[model samples]
Target chain A: MTDLAARQAELVRALLADGPVPAGFDPDRVRAEAAALLAKRRGVAARLRPDLAATLGDRFRPLFDTWARENPRRAGESFRADLDAFARWLQERERQERERRSGHRLD
Target chain B: MGLPTLGVGIGWRSEIDLTVERLPGVDFVEVLAENVSPDPLPESLRVLRGRGVPVVAHAVSLSLGGAEPVDPRRVAHLAAVAEAVDAPLVSEHVAFTGAGGLDSGHLLPLPRTREALDVLVRNVRAAQQDLPVPLALENIAALLEWPDGELSEGRFLAELVERTDCWLLVDVANLHANATNLGTEPGRFLDELPLERLAYVHVAGGVRHGDLYHDTHAHAVPPEVLEVLGELCSRVSPPGVLLERDDAYPPDAELAAELAAIRAVVSR
Candidate 1:
């Protein structure tokens, strides 16, 4: 890649993924910017899949933030994959909670 | 300069189809280019077109500033939508959405360096070559500034317009966000821009999140943003002003009132 292209890619990684804040960049500001991007994505997911958003209720933004921290957005997918992954993550958490509740009752 | 005085309009979305259809004062509607298929245009858009209300194709995913060349398929889709709508012109952002093969899912600002400007100019010219209608570029609201930027946003945009001979899509809400967050004066930013190149203006709503202003488009148009619109009109009345409400739509009456308010500002 050209130097400019390489620098641009590094900046995108820093924003979307957990890549390091590039040299000579303000770390705090970039972190804030990354958080803002994730928040915007969360809003889109909430709009596209209101059912999943409602199911997660208050924990929606936080959970999506956690997921987005690790997963970069796939081009042309339009967050369908992210929403599906979020739904499954919620289901697993619910299942774990159910098992814990049943174990407590048995005790 | 070829665009007519389209008056006040709204961004058409599926959620607010009935509202947009019934809005009386709307002169035109802008459809998200990515959302419509020319083979089967949405009924809402067809109704507007049938009524002789102009529909402008506005694209969000072109990623015109990305390091990669502008995707021909996306440009072709935009061309098809413009033809389908018979639009006077189409609009896309001056920002890049993705790099390194990952979609940012939102418009990200380009570094205001000469090299970045060259990349944007190249991509924009490519898209312009394919598009059936003229293309206007909108400046986006960004929270972060690249440390490597050498020129101001206005100078960078003016140079791009001069180089490409393209039109401008000035989003007033975005100006407000940048002015508030980046410590730039809105009027000064407007002055730096080539106002005569304006095809239309975008007026949306946003909220102040802590120290930053977020141009959410889901909130009500605040007075400060309206004031900036008023200032722009005082300088040069654009051919059109569009109200963009992507979500959290209010009642029909509320939406109408917002359109009326925009008309009042532009006509003043």
Candidate 2:
């Protein structure tokens, strides 16, 4: 890849993916920026689906953060679709947690 | 070619659709290109357009500065929206939104190296060719500055304009945020910029978080940002000035007051 293409790719990976900050750039600022981007997603998600925020309540951020790590928004994915996917993810997690508890009770 | 006079305007959001209609002295309004469909323009937008108010299409996901070539579909959508709304011009950010397999879902900053500028210029020209109306590029608020920059933001924009002859949508809130967060001299940026090519100006509110100013666009336009707008107005009377409030839907009274404040600055 050309130097420009490589740098742009690395920068995007560093920001959205869990990739290392490219050389010469400020690591702290890059990391801070990544966090800020996630924070922005959280804000939009909460506003988009207040029911999710209310249902999850205190667990919303932690759960959303987990879902976000596993699912970095795909290129060109609309915010609304991403949030709906998060709702599905949360429901699946809740089902698994219930199944695990029920299996323990059977023991 | 000269630009149309847009006068004072506000960003049109679905949440505050009624509020925008109620507000007075609104010469025009901008609609997010991604949010509207040209085939059937939203009722709110139709009402505004029916009143003979101009609507400008502002797109967020163009990824204009990405290494990848500009997406033809995205450019096509922006063009269709502009035609539907009868916009004088359409605008997108100078920053790239996402790249590779992941989407940041927010406007991301670009490195100021010559190599990056070359890629950006190529991508911008490609999209500009497809756009139906004149394309205006806006300066985004960057929280992180990449290392080993070759050109200042102003010089980079000036050169890009020189190469393509696109218009500029200067966002003063972003200027304030960059100055506070990355020490970018807003004054020097304006001086270096070719203000004659300005299409319009964006004025939004932001909150200072810890050490950085977050261009949230959810709060009232701060005095520091207004000062930056005043500075730009002093240099050149921009054809338009817009107040953008994205998330927190304020009351009609407050929205009118903010619009009035922006008018006061440019009216001078």
Candidate 3:
């Protein structure tokens, strides 16, 4: 793999290290799309708020793109709900990160 | 009869209650029903009324174009608030905010199709029937476009108003944003639209992304939108026009300055 590809894979690996890649998630595809998205503009991905970038990297792009393609016009609410879930998931991940560093879970 | 020519009115807020109460030259206050309590009207509205300020209710959460059933409870709430304030009209967005059971955190556009038109007409009719005064639907700033748009936004709006006999609340900022984003001419869009039906106009600021524009409402109104609104005022000369400042609020002086710019244009 190219150096950029290798670094991109490593980032994805670090993000997904908590568990097996969740069902229906393709880390390779996410990395590929992220790379392509980055290639179109060097700092484009970085411009996204960190939390949103990480969530899109890990969960949203895969879920919504798939759901939106399959359902087309019918996917209006479903598409939005999936993105909201992705944002909420990112919030949880940030909370977990804070907890791990603090030596106590929030719950 | 239509609403009278109320000079410059700012988007109503509770934080500025004292300012609104104490001010002498203010024309009308657009009360946000979403910000008020669920119960009938409150003392704040009473204060505006007592101060001899005409109050109009503007709704933010109606999701008028959503696929879900219109929330009768919320409509009832709006009706009660309108009655309480003795508002002349109640306005909501043409776009849907909540979809697929999730609040999108934004106003999304409906595709310009016959089906979408039918849906908008039905929703507007429902709101008009439930509310106390004439129902007004405002144009929205859309981030995306449908693949099969069959009509221009202005024409779509004209058709909706005609079908439902409803009034239009033209948000010039949104019109400008769509023009820049969609590669259309803002003046052309305004020329084609039925300007006479406009009951109110909204002007706000936005952010731009490479060839696209986003209506962030975080700054002073851009000159392009102000120009279109000026044209609207002369052509239609609507009763009330309100400036929508949802983010990065400038000081009252700055806002008043912007309002003055609009007044100078419309008055000319």
Candidate 4:
């Protein structure tokens, strides 16, 4: 890749993923910018998957933020994929919580 | 060529189709190019076209600033939509949406360096070759800037316009957000633009999140953004002005009131 292309890609990775901020950029500001981008993504996802949004209720934004940190959005992928992945994550968390509660009750 | 005077309009989103269709004063509607299907245009959009209201194909995924050459398939889709709608023009952002196989999910800023400018100009020229109508580029609201920027946003955009001879889709709310977040003067930025190339203006709402002003079209048009729109009208009466509300849609009366507000400013 050309220097410009490589630099651009690095900057994007840093913004979308938790990659290091490219040299000479302010880390705090970039973090703020990334947070803003994720917030916008949550809004779009909410519109696209209103069912998941309603089921998650007020937990949507925070839960989406957690899911987004681990899964950088792929190019040309639909919001349905993200919605499905988030739904699975929520289910898994609930199952684990239920297992722990059952264990405590048996004890 | 400049666009004809399209008095006042709103972006046509499927969520607010009924409100947009019922609204009385809207002169035109902009549909996202990606959402449209040429083989079978949506019924609501067909109704608007039937009513003699101009429908503009506005694209969000054209990533014109990406290092790669413009995608031929995306360009083809935009052309098909424009032809299907009989649109006079299409619009996309001056920013990149994704790169390196990862989608940013939002428009991201490009470094104002000469290399980035070269990439943008080449991509735009390539996209223009296939587009049935002229492509107007809108400046985005970026929260961060690159350390290697060699030019101001206005100068870079002016140069891009001069080189490509593309029309400008000036977004007043975006200008306000940049001015508020980046410490640039919105009026001064407008002054630096090539006014003759202005094809239309976009007025939207934004809210201040802490110190940063988010140009969230989902909110109400703040008074400061309206002032920026008023200032733009005073400087140059653009051929068209549009209000874009993506989510958190208010009532039909609220939407009508916003359109009336823009009309009042433009007619002044």
Native contact fraction (fnat) of model 1 = 0.60
Residue B95, model 3: lDDT of 77
The DockQ scores of all candidates, in the order shown, are: 0.65, 0.75, 0.05, 0.66
Q: The CA-based lDDT of model 3 is what?
A: 0.65
Report residue A13 deviation for candidate 2 (angstroms). 2.0
Q: Between prediction 1 and prediction 3, which has the larger DockQ?
A: 1
Alpha-carbon runs more than 4 Å astray in model 3? A1-107, B22-24, B38-42
After TM-score superposition, what is the CA distance of residue A41 in candidate 3 from its true location, in Å?
Answer: 26
User: How much native contact recovery, as a fraction, does model 2 achieve?
Assistant: 0.75
What's the distance in Å from true for residue B27, model 1? 0.6
lDDT of 3 by residue, A1-107 (tens): 43322332333332222223323335543343233322222122223334565646755455434433332222233333444554565578679888797886443
Clashes of each: 0, 0, 2, 0
Model 4 clash pairs are none
TM-score of chain A of 2: 0.92
Error of 1 at A2 (Å): 2.0
Cα lDDT for residue B24, candidate 2: 93
lDDT of 4 at B109: 87
Q: What interface RMSD do all candidates show, one decimal each?
A: 1.2, 1.3, 16.5, 1.1
Residues B1-268 of candidate 2: C-alpha lDDT, one tens digit per residue: 8879999999999999988887899999999998889989989999999999999999998999988777789999999999999999999998887777678888988888888888888988899889888999999998889888899999999998998888999999999999999999989999999999999999999898799898999888999999999999889999999999998777789989999999899988
